[model samples]
Target: MTLTLTDETPPKGFERLVRAEDPASGLRALICIHSTALGPAAGGCRMWNYARWDDARHDVQRLAEGMTYKNAMADLGLGGGKSVILGDAKRDKTPELFRAFGRAINALNGSYYTAEDVGTSPADIAQAATETPYAVGLEGGQYGSGDPSPFTAEGVFQCLRVGAKHVFGSEDLTGRQVLVQGLGHVGMSLAEKLHAAGAALIVTDIDQAALDRAARGLGATVIAPDQVFATQMDIFAPCALGAVLNDTTGPQLTAKLICGAANNQLAHPGIAGALHARGIRYLPDYVVNAGGIISVAGEIHKAGPGYRRDRLAGIAGRVDAMLTRAEQEDRNTTEIAADMVKEILASANRNVA
Candidate 1:
């Protein structure tokens, strides 16, 4: 169930912890990097039934590193780390398993903190807290502290506006035909913003309830989840899993811009060149989808007592600026935005050094 490929590079400050209790219930965590340059590393734990252990390991490593860059780019004073549970969410989810994972993290003291992500929820985080006090996003009866999907979607929405301005001449979403490839929590939240902007929405989701919700509430036109490969729209928003822009789908895309909350949109590194060839403006995932982490980081650091909404609204403005700078520099938005973030981190590193 648990598979790992050891490498020397190990992603700067990588730490892998595995707790084997039985063949069926093993917990594995990979903390890809430490941002002692900033502060304690904090991130969400993603639980999924990856087909292979290598797949889960790869996902954890890449996502953890992405979180580091995302936090640095968003000016969050926190490092990045991620946890992955290798099992089916529906059938394999047990409080015991989560508790085991929490104990594993507890052993690390506070080097890597955990929250809710993907298949994990607030209740699961609460279960995790039963073992480790480091877990966040607890339910205190009022509004839950977990489920940061809407915040993530809001950030992506802002980034999309910036992309629209760069690709077209306007930042408004009105009259834009936006095709959303995933109807998950983030995608659905983003759909509300697109609808509010008077954009024509084309939605796709494997979950019928989510599709129905989008159709009934947002008046969005639902499409088969796989049909996004051939959908014709100004923007192709991928809010779900990563690596959708592979060789097979990249060449056939009709969207002028590809900007969304999904991480690692390119199936491979060369896909960027291919998207560049197609004139598709690619917004780097970490830069665009950082609102959730920013919010959680604020909570974690006690940055402020209030102003959460205003802080979130500011992400849109920053995204818009990044988009404008990319067009003015005549470079791919992904490269430009990522380079800016790298410069910031490099500066931070130098000051520390």
Candidate 2:
């Protein structure tokens, strides 16, 4: 199906370019949202063969907005934005396609920067970098670029430790059973941490290679993705896609804690309350997964390695503080975390103007 782009999306406080032809690569393009509230907008460029244009639009808008909040929460001086290419990643990838993407990004005049996301890789970002110097997360030990997935995993692992302390009143995962849904880079890293802490690990992924790796490397029990939602584990870690929590699956979860690297995990606004009703503690996705953004933000602003490390370590500590506040105030962790993020963003806005 040919997906057409509409020019009428809330004005977005920026520009939206939808192109079909390119001198570099011939592919459908949608450069969504450009915001200058903080500084230059930086976000991942996700490539996927969407079932519809609307799906692509939703992904770009939601992800761009998530990036905005993610950066704001991390105290990064970057606005949020995202780009999406409609085509099969495996079948339609080509130099021409990426080159065209580079050109599109180049036209943005540095208003938006691109990075790697699901279906997009560092190699792809490198290809796009060939067209524009604004692209980030390039491989080859580039000076200002590094893959953010591992950092994302590190943050999630730290948040899990915090969750354990708040709910179980201990940070040790020795006897805890964690069901990690999605054995990708982030998920596998988180599982390794859990294993290192002597926790029992159960992992699931659609890719057999990932499953086999988890089983071999971490001694994780591989299960089907669907089983993760209903697994009788202490923690349900979702390191996969977004919107996994909803009416259907929220009430069915048997895990005592829900924490992972996935962004925008809640299907809707009320899902947090649903988890609360079931006595399930949910670590807010945006707050917990801000590690990658923090790392990248440091690099972009030339904050140095020590600053980045301090920032990453500070995530675990902040998670601990948030959890403690939640328990002390008899409030849900998600609510308290969101309030913290809101205050941070508000402070940032004040600083900016």
lDDT scores in order: 0.75, 0.78
Model 1: residues >4 Å from true position, as ranges? 1-31, 48-57, 141-144, 303-307
Per-residue lDDT value at 178 in model 2? 92
- The window of 10 residues in a row where model 1 has the poorest summed lDDT is 1-10
How well is each residue in 1-353 modelled by candidate 1, as lDDT tens digits? 23232332454455443322333445544444445466667788888888876787688877777777777777776777777877777878888778777776676678777888878888888888898877887656333355677778877887788778878889888889999888877888888999999999999988999999999999999988778877789988998888988999899899988878887788887887778767888878877788778667756665552444665666666667776776687666667767776787788889989
In candidate 2, position 12 carries an lDDT of 44
| Highest-scoring model, lDDT | 2
Clashes (N, CA, C under 3 Å) per candidate: 0, 3
Q: How well does each candidate superpose onto the true structure, as a TM-score?
A: 0.84, 0.85
Give the runs in model 2 whose Cα sits over 4 Å from its true position. 1-24, 51-54, 141-144, 207-213, 222-226, 328-331
Error of 1 at 16 (Å): 7.2
Give the per-residue lDDT of model 2 (tens digit) for 195-247.
99999999988999998988999999888887766678999899888899988
TM-score of 2: 0.85
Candidates in order: C-alpha RMSD to true structure: 4.0, 3.7
